[model samples]
Target: MKKMSKLEAVLWNIAFPGFSQLLMGHYIKGVLFVVLEFVMNVNSRFNQAIMYSFLGEIEKAEMVINYQWLMFYPCVYLFSMWDGYRSAMPADEKYSFLPFVFCAYFVTVGLMVSPKVTIFQVHPGPVFLPMLFLIPGLLIGFFIKFLLAAKLYTK
Candidate 1:
């Protein structure tokens, strides 16, 4: 029997993005990234709701947290695809961590303070506090990948 070509494999990766990466042998990178995306998606949903409430749009925030696809899922999936593609790249290239960090900070800030929506509600509960840990955790993950990139490519 004939075997599938590399292009076919890469195209499969595009379909699910990370699946092909796993098939190709980047299990650590692919699995971890998929997990990270899932965690962030959940966090984004929770925070997006809180942010909406802070902005005084309780209903909108609630709606977003409960069921807003346009706001979060697509973004997270795209990010996963990007990461998967990156992981699949030749292991001798330096990946930039700055862009990811900047984007994360921007989103956090936007959630915390968007003038278009008035933040009339503030929740000082355990919810807002978790992000204090999550932000840094996400950054650390990004840096870990950056380190791997540098280490792999530096040689």
Candidate 2:
């Protein structure tokens, strides 16, 4: 199999969690990611929620979403992106996992609050709300990673 570029890996993983792994020839792990993602998608009623949300049926979308199953999504999804990106890199970069980890954490928090939280009186629903949280998560994670690296190097 041809090695995927880091961007290719991340984008593929974004499309589906394990595509990059499969492209990179980590068959077992790739299959596992796909399976896990499928299971979560099914149990969470994610697709149904997405459809309803897109149709402007916010209440129905909220009603259909299974928060328990949905909560696991951010962790699995972000982990796959991080793993794919990390695997594609020729050299290991320390603290790289922090951004993904924090993103997952913030996304999960966003999911928890999606039902009640709104910005400027507008509800972004389950999907968009969590996505909005991703920015702060990434920023905080990268900032922390940078500080950690600086501290380690300056010592």
lDDT of 2 by residue, 1-67 (tens): 7687889999999999999999999999999999999999999999999999889888899999999
Q: What TM-score number comes out for model 1?
A: 0.35
Backbone N/Cα/C clashes per model: 3, 0
Predicted model with the maximum lDDT: 2
Clashing pairs in 1: 54-119, 55-118, 55-119
Best by TM-score: 2
Q: How well does model 2 score by local distance difference test?
A: 0.94
> Residue-wise lDDT of candidate 1 within 7-105, one digit each (tens)?
554466446535655665768766765675556557657557667656666567645653333234334544555455454455554554343444445
Error of 2 at 116 (Å): 1.0
- Candidate 1 Cα errors over 4 Å, as ranges: 1-24, 39-58, 62-85, 88-95, 115-155
TM-score, model 2 to reference: 0.95
Q: Rate the local accuracy (lDDT) of all candidates.
A: 0.51, 0.94
